[model samples]
Target: MSERINDIMNEEPKRGRSAFQPLIYAILVVLGVYIGSNFSGNSTFTHRPAASENPNKLVNIINKIDEMYVDSVEKKALIEKAINAMLEDLDPHSYYISSEELASVQEPLQGNFEGIGVEFMIQKDTLVVVSPIQGGPSETAGIRAGDRIVEVDGEHIAGIGLTNSKVMEVLKGEKGTKVDLKIQRRGTDDILDFNITRDRIPIYSVVASTMVEPGVGYIKLTRFAKNSYEEFMMGMAKLDEAGAESIIFDLRGNGGGYLHVAIPMVEEFLEDDKLIVYTEGVNSPRSEYRSQRRGRYADKDVVILINSGSASASEIMAGALQDHDRSITVGRRSFGKGLVQDEIPLPDESALRLTVARYYTPTGRSIQRPYGEEIDYDNDYNDRYDSGELYSEEKIELNDSLKFTTPKGRIVYGGGGITPDVFVPIDTIGASWYFSDLSYAGTIRRYGFDYSDSHRDELSSYSDVESFLKGFKVTNVMMEGLFKAGEEDGYERDERAIAESGEVMKIRLKAHMAKNLFGDEAYYRALLEDDNVYDAALEVARNYKDYAIVDGELTLLSATEVEEAMTTN
Candidate 1:
């Protein structure tokens, strides 16, 4: 009976083992099938491996060397070099502003900065103060003309490789900061030290605003800064108060500034809801700016003056007014700069003013001239000159690929600057190499300043411009001194040319002297006594019909009548 029971147990054990083995094998097979399916799925979704390392692997290698190499490398210096290299490939206007150079570069365009305001020039390796800005810290601190800056903040600045930018850096600081400056005056042997508490120096955009003729106002804008619109409005109000019937907005050498300032200035001429300008770009949304109801000179006859340097916002104002037939644009073709640059701030306190959008006129004309692949902006104006477009009447060819018409059906060109209604050729008759050398060598300014100083008492007696003009004389003595100075500087004076240019040179010298002594208004008041362009604009303003014809619109006067009126006027 024991043997039979043991046999049954062994058979039972065998049967249990076989059942468990089969179950385990089935579980293993299922697990293996699941694993295979997951592997196949992952293979289908995964990316392929690269055959070689990335092209920018050198950058990574350099970074590793900078981090863990035995020898130390200046990472900041490398970054500045890289930044300069990057900017070199961009446009000429696109420049890298180092941390130390940012403020001085932006001061003029911003209209104000903290400093002792003085315009200066370098002469004979010495810093010569040209003129102190009116009501500025330098004037307040008793810094006068003919003072030479020898030291700033205890550092010897004279006879060193001190640049204009470096001088600005040393002179300008936050308001309430004191700067110690050592100045050498012309009459004094001992150096004069001035401890000036820097204050906010106002940079003017509107250089002059005066009555050019009876009932005709003139305002010369040097730039469109932050306070430009306000300054312009003030000028207009002053002119209106003086019974000005027409206005001439001069934008001759204005390279332009804030668009916000420009739009409102154009609004002063246009009515409400009139399109001023529009911008478009790939990454930027289309933006359209229209005139609002807050205009001051909406009912006045306006003439805008432009030249080769009048660019960006100036072009916008001129184009908007021309497209709407609100004003007649005079002078030369404007500098084409219809692209919007946005100042993008970086982590290192540096900024990137990248061109983000292209601007268009109300008539849908794009004023952006072609840029080469290498972006040589120096040849831009020269190309215009070479094409004979600046001074010729070769139909003023427009790119048909980008032409548009104004609301009044006037043909407008595109892919270039705002074409003036009346083109004025540059006055180059007296621009001989001798004249250029004298102008460039500071001979004009130096002689003018010296003459003004010697005759200050007598010159100050004439309170009015007309009286002063008649009283002050650029005599033979002054001319002789100027000629001698020019000769000493290796500039040979052309006898006939000098005689021919005498009138213009004398007038400009007197004007510069007046500016240094009195103000910008006085200078312009003296200079405009014989400006041909201003006279032409005044004539246009005197006749509304002539103005309308030039603005590409038919008027009450016929072509014959207009010609007769122009002849008579």
Candidate 2:
């Protein structure tokens, strides 16, 4: 739901990248632009034809190239490359989108897209259905998990060097359009066929919601999409139903999406008319977005999880709440993204996403990291890593010139990413070179999918996540097989290394298997067994006041201050 700015961005490399990497790379690409879902509507002026065919500098140059080049040139490709160069020079965030790339770039953030609605993977030259998206056309049409898609529309797609793009080209179509698929099911002698009509399959932003503990609800929001506010509300309702007294809002690695989506989403946590965030730029006037109503969970303790991958709307959500001292933000500093973008449609369907404004937190904090004019914008992450910022909150550089104070008199700094109230350094407790080597060879994913696929009959016995957690265990035999897989991948077994990393490996193996068998929630539940940031959030949520910044220090508020904050909120 976040990080993909253009449809075909790093297309091949994207196949193996975690869903979290896009936002970081994307924010780095665009700087800090968050183009709203209603992109075309945000155009400040209509794209008009010039008096002459070749008017602008670039266009005139393109015309000259077309007129006198030694060989024929692709005018469209030329124009796109020129546009890319232009945007790359402007800032990190401003960029152009080709018409073909526009829809796919916006699909995940728009909340839905037309597709066959089966999550798939290209394994060993065959397209296998990982799971049918719930209530999707493929699911409704009876496509089952582990079904091998042999042919599409009578054309053999399997064993034909299939790529994600190739699969998308064939499977995704206009709603109500039927596509024929020949499938090879397990234990079935005959090939089965399913004619599935494509439909609007939802791309969920709230990836997981669960009662991590009694009276504690944890919602992992991956991005702020068009439906994210509604999705978050649904999550909150579920947690409330489960008797959750506190909330752990996990926005870790969330790259961010629609700005409007973020505003309303954060409005769910603030008092009426409280300044949530504001925007200002030289060309764009100052615009303030205030909370419209008293939020539903104003009095409930909230803990926000953030990290270097959290940017734009993720920063917005974290910054606003942190400014109000409404939540205890934990983990590393946020991905600094303070710019706002407005999408302008060009003469063609392609559009220009131009940065128009800079967003500021209520405390007047600019969460934009410095860039341009000798600044190594791309190397900022590396600099942070080298400077020990990830390992120590004290290492985060803050500017006193940009210092601001929250209404509660808590001193906060600006001009960098949001610094968490409680910091959880990168966990190195179980890290070792051996574990790194084992992980480098795809042992976890390979073992997980292969095991799940082979033991489907046994895994299907667990009716729910709770039962699976209780019933499933990574036995010694499974560990041996996993180690053997690592060895096959060229990682030699070091007894000391295995001793150090074996438990962590089991947790990952179990999580991946749970994800493949059950769903995303199960995967997160399995990994929560060893998550440091999550553990911090849980502890802080239960005793948030112990870490609350009152008078710029972690101290319990007096009875009068507590009553005032309660009344004000």
Candidate 3:
């Protein structure tokens, strides 16, 4: 039986070993197929590139760095560097505003901010209050003129590298928030501390508006803000109600603001369907602005004033008036800032003020001057001066490439600012080094403030600005004091120069005093008596028929007839 069993086992090829061998082989084949299929599925799904992965072109470089680089590198830092490098190739006006500085940059253009409302200057490492804005928190807090802010919230802020922006950051807060300020007075020894509650401070666009002469109105605009058009209309309406037959719109130091504000302001002076200004750019769509309604002062004799600091929207208004032969432009040439900037917000709550388009006048003249890899702003006004364009009748060199004809067929030049129809040169007659020193040293302002404070009651007795001007005098004693003050500051007083500038000094001192005692209107009314620009404008308006000659032929009729024609035509 044993022999027979051994034979059967041998024939079966050993039950334990041979039976498991085939099973092991089948299991190995099934395991191999499962592993292969799993790997293939992973390659199609789990091995795919991530959503935030870099591009295919950078994959090889990344692999090389990962394999051979000496140090670990962060991808975020490299991405930021690339973005900054890209923005550097754009224009100077195109700028990035960080999230921290976004609100401060937008506040001024928006026309209101929460602050104490005092314009200040840092002189001699001391915080000097220049002027308290009218109807503001500072004024309401009884913050007087010439007060120095020595501390803010018990922290010393006078001379410790405090910047203007830093000071504003400390002072400005939400409306109704109280801020403690320690002030140092010139005449007082005790430090005065006041808890001032911040309010919505209005930055005015119309600086001063008054009836200059019997029938002429004067309005000075400082900036084109959101309320600029409304302010301008109010001034014109007031002037018209005050029996003003002619208007002088002063845009001397106005650095422009919103384009929308400027367009409507232009419409206030132009007739319906008149072209105001246009804009075009390489990547931007062409846009044309026209007056949609009749103007309030369409029939009134108008003169527009411009200077070197008059830029952007100011240039647009002056250029439009000049192109349409609507008003006489006086004073120096304007600042040529024709580019329009659009504020675009970023993902991080920051913003980008990007230059997107270039503005052009109604005559198709571009007001933008050339600027490239290197900007040469030094030749801006000096070139105009050297060419005798400020005071001479000699015509400016009109580049045929830039020439564009106005509606009246008058030739106008582009590639720069609007050249005034009547040029009024800067009055440098009384501008000696001594005068400059006195002006810069704050001697004139200090003396004026002191004088006004001392003689407030006496000065206030006068009925009006004209009466005050006639009665008040900047005496020889005052002049001697001013000269001595100027001399102590290392300025040698030239006797002949002082005598030549005596009238100018007297007028300036009186005007400053008037401003301190009464208001800006009183000051400007006094200063307008000797203004050469105003004199020229008055002359032009007085003889409109002769001055408005196109192609040397009289175009304007009598003033009354012109008004009638304006209404009829």
Q: Whose lDDT is greatest here?
A: 2
Model 2 spans with C-alpha error above 4 angstroms: 1-61, 432-442, 487-496, 548-551, 555-569
Highest-scoring model, TM-score:
2
Estimated TM-score for each candidate: 0.80, 0.87, 0.76
Candidate 3 lDDT score relative to the true structure: 0.71
What does candidate 3's lDDT look like per residue over 103-166, in tens digits? Answer: 7666656678888888776655667675688899898888876789988888888888768777
The residue ranges of model 1 lying beyond 4 angstroms of the native Cα positions read 1-95, 123-126, 147-166, 180-194, 374-377, 529-532, 549-569
TM-score of 2: 0.87
lDDT against the true structure, each candidate = 0.72, 0.79, 0.71
- Backbone clash total for model 1 is 0
Name the lDDT value of residue 530 in candidate 2: 90
Every model's Cα RMSD, please? 20.7, 6.8, 21.2
Model 3: per-residue Cα lDDT at residue 358: 88
Clashing pairs in model 3, backbone N/Cα/C closer than 3 A: none
Q: Residue-pair clashes per candidate, as listed?
A: 0, 4, 0
Candidate 1 residue 535 C-alpha distance from true site, Å: 3.6
Task: Write one digit per residue (lDDT tens) for candidate 1, span 1-569.
Answer: 00000000000011122323432332332222332333344331133325663424433544564688566757555444444444444533444455665665567667898888888877666787878888898998898876899999899988997788788789888899999999998767898989998899899989888887788899999877778888998999999999987898888778777777788899988888999999888887998999978567888888888877888888888889888888877777777777776654444555545566788899988887666565555566786778776677454666778766677766667787888776666666455667777888888877777777666666778787656766777777778788887887788878987877777777777887887667678788777755766666777777744544434433446688778887888
